[model samples]
Target chain A: MRSKIVLVLLLVLYGCSFFLRGEDPKLDLGDNVMEGVFFQGGYGMQWVHDTAAEFERAHPEITAYVWGNPRAWDQTRPRFLSGNPPDVFWGIHNINFWVNLHDGLVANLDSLMEAPAYGQEGVKFRDTFFDGTLEEGQFEGHQYFLPITYAISGIWYNKGMFDEHGWTEPETWDEFLALCETIKQTGGGVAPLTHQGKYPSYFGMIWRGLVYKLGGEQLMCDMDSLVPGAWSRPEILEACRLSRQLYERDYVLPGTSSFSHTEAQMIWIQGKAAMIPCGTWLASEMKNALPEDFDMRLMSVPGFRDGKGGIGAMEASAGPAFWIPVEAANPLAGMEYLRILLSRKMAANFLSTVGSVQPIKGSTEGVNVPPATQSALDRIAAAGGETFAFQFSGWYLELENEYRNALGALLNDDITPERFAARMEAMAERLRQDPDTIRFSRSPRGDGVAAL
Target chain B: MSLQNNGRVALLFVLPAFLFYLTFLIVPYALAFGVSFVKWRGVTLNMEYTGLGNFAKMIGDPFFWKSLYNTVFFTVLTGIIVPCMALYFAVAVTRKLVAGARFFRITFFFPNLISQVAIAVLWWFALNPEFGILSNFLRLFGFTDLPSWLGEPGWARAAIVAVKVWAAVGFYMVLYVSAIEGIPEDYYDACKIDGAGEWQSFRHVTLPLLSEMMKVTGVFLLLNGFGTFDVVRIMTDGGPDRATETLATYIYENAFELGKFGYATTIAMTLFLITFSLAMLSLWIQRRDSVEY
Candidate 1:
């Protein structure tokens, strides 16, 4: 009897391990069920849940099981490996979209894009979104990914503080520098500028804006395409020099480099710093911590006097990519879910809930947007479709990291502007030379060489 | 019952745990070993065989060398500093030389009870340059040119080491305290009966008997040092231009951030070899030098 009891206990333990490896029950719920996973980031998952519910309500034939967490990709990655991926997913930064496209993991969404809009009477699904917003998701003229939101990167400042201090928004690089100096002298102890230093890539937006200002949009395109010696251009070095001066002149907040994104933003919101560089999502992300009557506003990066791209060129693009796996159980359902999610009604709901804009055309119509996002929309309207986005950084991790690290080093005064340019050029050269490294090419917007 | 029946019972008891170990640990490691020789982008669907290529690439990569140097630096410094400080405190508290010995013991061990990520965040805040406790305290005097501890490369490494030591020394100190308490008091009494002074008695009796525990703690700390991921990941994120990039962080960056599974696993294999060899070498040295009491 004792031996039998011991054997039973061993068998029980083994059974428990097997139970631990059991598949998620939702997987066996049949074809009508569609699984959708998302990254619960700055924009909370309320929108995802609402969209899912709406999707299921609209298409009564399908059941949408959508879930998200801050780090949901950790769980989703294994599911992909096991050939049991969600029908639709978003925010797996590890999977390079281009590489996935090459490996036949991402479904080609060309037919979905060409399909008629879900709610609109006669508009194609592709036409429902704002112009130039859907271009980034295209690989070899086929859509493989779609963006959930749109954002414009710029310099954010407290309008209340600016008005009190008699500070006017600058339109040129020289005026911006003079304003910085004036702020340094008169704005009490507040620094002229601050940035998300721990995440050094925040500085890249400002740098890219400067690049576009000094050089033309074509120059930006050439650099993105990995054209030889493009990174070593004089315009690139000048942008490096101008950005470095922010640190050298002590215009940046002291010890800003040690701060996490939120810590730096908190300082900016506390009136410790006069301005900060961030995307339109900044105000929404910090809504809980913001003080009363902060009056946050964003301004485009000031252009140079001799710049080619003009001050109106705003670097606006879609954000937080979405994709459907090729092996999804319910591909049609997933596409339908996307159409519902991107409908103009849901887009307005997203703005009210998340305080950000979606790429859906006229999504901001009649929506009471927060002050900061309104500023971004105003900046975008003023640009009149003169916008550009860099695809190289998203495509190449090695080059992106090198550029970010080099930018950090340069800002810290650890390296010269020339050396910074050299490092970037060398990395670009290496990438261009490596046959195994997948490369993407594009021409300037409206250049007729690529489909804008 | 026969002796064979006892053996059968023991085998039955061990089988469940052994199967779990084989399935989770051994099989995964074997798979990783095979993957280290292939070129994979980590989507789990596509792989190309590249035998010895990943190894050669790792050998030639400057970033790998830098990470290795950083890892070794952290491990050696932590190993030396943590043990010495722990042993000293353990001796003091065990001997009751300090007042409020119980209070002191608990205070030292408190940090160990807290999570490592929490400790790192607390330290990161404390060392913040603008409004951090350390910076404000320094500024209370005339010192205004405070260095950015987490921003500058050299200072960031120093700061990481200090935080790791602070969080680690407590647990090791508790370990030493127990080991010292377990030493037979009769030996010390015998030393007192002789003309041996306190220092001499401790050197001859305490040091010799503690060697076994020392070896055990040494191996434990060595393993801990090698797997130093959480604190660094939370604190500096191997930043200030990768100045604090340890092998662990670099492996994570490669595999997850860059999707270079083959190269990451190759580095992992190398790290395992290095860790295993060093651990064995330390054990051999300890066994040879350990005094039989």
Candidate 2:
């Protein structure tokens, strides 16, 4: 009888612990005044949280919680689907992610922008941000998210190594090829270009560069729906031919398909590879992961000819944006907090600390940006280049998988370029037919292009 | 009164275990079945009744089919190779054929004690194509080139199977060793008295006795074959053209990576079905009367 009582007591204690552990209850504020903004964990997020706390102290009623990354997006989706998302949520520019979720789960920020409290701030914020960054946040003439950071994808090289060797950055595709030859002749045993070839997404990045060189920004806009004989077009064929040439010439790392992004980055840092095609994040990662003496520099990927820029030639901007959920306990409070964050002073602080380019005007000046990055930014601004859209964005999940698979097959020589294009067309066709796939206003209307 | 009291006591003793089985196993299984039929993106509260839509999609998905094929291939290879190797080692150890038999047994079993993830990382470095020990060694033998073992189609699958077999062999060997030791020494003595050769004794007496243990091991191996995930996940991540993808990894990718809960559950149901049927078939084949000796 005593043992049974002991067992019962233990069971009761175990059950009680389950209910005891969880997030603390949200603090209550009287009369719906400023409460706080919650953020997920990231290098950028830490800055946001710190800045948020300062803003709150200046205006005592407000408070903020900086949470860890929402690793359980699957577990959290049900709450989002129920229309009760967090008061402040993170947004990504990629299609079918946080920004698109705003279509159904979030309040239309456009409506919020029209409010008197928001109107002046909204217009000022809009003017300060780069046009391309702003354009990426708009869908169907309504802004769903605010672009927070701008990233440029390009070829990063060891500047010191180039200076010592008397080698200059290549200005054209032919020049780039010649540079590879020169490096090989000069007894640099390493490949000229290193990238994460195993991931099909990396291949898509190269394709984006080539496509931009061939047709400029318009090519990306019209990629989902191609005109008749698109695959057989001379420019597209040239892109494929050039890629194959690079492979045959052994200009890319041998066993390139085996290396992960991190592995490739390490190789580049160790001076094994002359150049690596990567994003602005590489600079910050290198600073943290490499020795202090590491001397890496970023450059816009070289052009295809004398004038046309290569793919990833200009800055590619995409990043997390802050949004207010409609079902928040204090929506007005959340909006006011966002306003504080978007202020020029706060934006500059974030940009400097996080190694990011803020989308606020005057935030770029006096900021401590690396010289190479500053140069790339200046070049993109000079060329009137806009945002580079991720090619697989705005497609169904299966369609994206198909593209990744096709690219993997292409890299392994399991499929020809013609077959790769055919497979992509097929995937696009499937997405067109799938009822769940979101259709943008600009989507192609008719069967002018045959379904693959 | 005595029989009835005994029956009540048996029921009382089983009640907790029965409740646990019902809650953890039966309830979740039923929930998963219900979930498999609906079109629910894991994140969204919204769900649509799709009946067999998810299953239908699974049948047509190339990745799904590829994963299933890989899983079967891995299972068959590991099931045959690991057990045979274990049995051979078991026989050798029991006969005291080698010096430091205990050391050999403990050393071989050491890998089984290490976490699968740790072992995978160790092997990954050892097999790294450019600077890895294996590739460097191969290059020394007049072979100037070698494929990345975990990064190519044929090789990735083979490497995954090899890792699984390596990790599993030791545990199964210990089982065989125990079973072999349990056999009465008198049987071998009798075989020698009858002028039976070593091979003849092993074929007749030892083989018959170990048959039951083999049946149990076979069933376990068959089930593990279908459910394998960690080694493959850590090693190849189902890449190099999805060559090393298995049903579990595919299901994980769908549910977590892609956020297609309905599709993932459907795949899981299919895996459970296959594993269940294979286990049942194995049990049927291995069924026999308990050995009296």
Candidate 3:
């Protein structure tokens, strides 16, 4: 009798295990069920959980199983090569992920953009966004992904400081330099401008702004096409010279090399610096870091003598995009979720919550945009400002690093402006020589042949 | 029959742990070696076998050389400074030369208990050139300007070493203290009876017996130095121009930041071989005959 009871209990336990391992009863989608379209959390996917819930409510046939940050591509790529990948991935850095698009790992969204449901919304979508946001997502005239947010790099200043000093905003290069001199003479002690010299991206912003101011939008655009010997040109030389002069005058903060972007911003907030070149995200971040009443203003980098000082180039770069992997268990459902995310309602919600500039058309109503940001938007619209050009997508990381190092050297007076220009030229020459090291098939004309 | 059954059960108990080691350790290491030969851009769906291309590339890579130099400099500095200071403190505590020995022990060991990330952040704040506590204190002494601790290349490397030593010396001090306590009191008593001074007793008797403990500490320090990453990354991110980069941080940046998986794995494999050989050599050299109790 004891042996029989043990046998019965063992059989029941084994039966329960099988029953528990069977399909989830909650998701009863019959034969049309789609799985694995939901992701819980990541750099840019915090909203996906809620978005997926809404998506599921609208489409009951689709079942989504959310996962973690798509196990960084270093780990995930091997799985992709082995024929398994996530249905959708979020938080992909724009420049690096462009390679995935070039390699055909992600679906081409051009056809989807043309479909009636997607096209009508997409055509209006293209027209509604700031001009350069979409360009960052495109390569060789085809779009692989849609930008969820657009980050524009510009100069942010403390209005209260400027006002307290009885100084007017400078409108030209001469005026800007004169303002720096005035600040110095008055013993402001604070730097006129603060930036992260250690980060190549921050220097890239200054370089792009200089290109725009000196040569105008067309010349800046030409530089990106690999115009041979472009850096050796007079305009580029003057920009380097001006940057060196600024450093010599101590116009920038001390120990800039040690500070990160956030640290530099903190200095500005604490009134240690008069100005900072940062992105639109700074407005929200500043609010969070300090009292809500702290006053700040955003404007373009001051321009040169020949150019309008307020007429600066703003960097409207690609932010983050979501991609549906080719090996996904349910590709269409993933794409549908993306579509919902790109919808006007979702765009407004994201903008309100995260202060991200949505790519969708029309202003986000009921979103409490900071007054300083609104003032910046107004300035840009009034000035007819041009968007800055990025030379190579993310593949230019090496080139950028070299340029930043040269700039840092120049800032420390370790290198001459002429030498800096020569180094910049050499970087272009190196890129031209080593096609494999800096490969971008989409832009074959980008072989140091274009001019700024 | 009963003894055989007991042996079988013991083997069964050990099987799970053995399987875990084989899966997690042995497999990943073998896979890392295999991946080192490929040219993979991490995110791409394709990989090409590059043979010895990556290893060859390391020869000319300035960043790799810079990182190696920094790692060696950091290791050498910490290896000498930490153990000496630890030994000094251990002697002081063991000899009862200082009052409140327990307080001193706890104070020295306190830093070791703090997470490296927290310590790095604390140092960063303290060293901030404009408003940091150290900077402010320096200014009060009429030194108006000082190089940023983690910004200038030379200073950055020095700061990294200093921070490592500060966080590490205490733990090693405790180790030395424990080892010194284990020495029989009779040796010291005999030395005193023989008219030997404290310093002479330490030099003649204490030093020789502590060789085993020194070897253990040295090996630990060497291995830890080779793998230094967190403090550098959090404090400097190998910056002010890659002046403070270590092998581990370099590998991470190449793999995650630059998307060069094959290149990063190649670096990791090189580091593994170098560190493994050095560790083995140290262990072999330190394998002295066990001293009689």
Best by TM-score: 1
Which window of ten consecutive residues has the lowest lDDT sum in model 2 chain A? A443-452
Q: What is each candidate's DockQ, to 2 decimals?
A: 0.60, 0.45, 0.39
lDDT, residue A57, candidate 2: 73
On the 0 to 100 scale, the lDDT of residue A184 in model 2 is 68
The per-candidate TM-score of the B chain, in the order shown, comes to 0.95, 0.94, 0.94
* lDDT by residue for model 1 (A1-452), tens: 99999999999999999879878767675668988999887898889899989997897878888888777666677777778788898865555667677777889899999998877888999999877778889887778889987888889998999999999989888899999999999999999998888878888888888998888777878888898988989999999999998888889998888888999999999998999999988987898998877798888888877788767677777743888998887887888889888999899899999998999987888999887898888886786657767767788878888888888888888889899988988889888877668887877655312233
Report how far off residue A100 is in candidate 1 (Å): 1.8
Cα TM-score per model:
0.94, 0.89, 0.85
CA-lDDT, candidates in order? 0.86, 0.69, 0.72
Question: How do the residues A206-325 of candidate 3 rate in per-residue lDDT, one tens digit apiece?
Answer: 656776677664455545555687667777777778877777787877777677777787888988888787777686665567656678777766677675222654666654366777
Answer with 1 or 3, whichever has the higher TM-score.
1
Q: Interface-residue RMSD per candidate?
A: 1.5, 3.5, 3.1
lDDT of 2 by residue, B54-137 (tens): 888888877789999988999899989998999888887887878889998998899988999898887777767767788899
Give, for candidate 2 chain B, the lowest lDDT window spanning 10 residues. Answer: B39-48
Predicted complex 3: CAPRI docking category: acceptable
lDDT of 3 by residue, B62-129 (tens): 78998898888888899999999999999999888799998999999999889999999999888777
Task: Please give the interface root mean square deviation for model 2, in Å.
Answer: 3.5
lDDT of 1 at B152: 83
**Which residue window of length 10 is worst by lDDT in model 1 chain A?**
A443-452
Clashes of each: 0, 3, 8
Query: Which of the numbered candidates is closest to the native, going by highest DockQ?
Result: 1
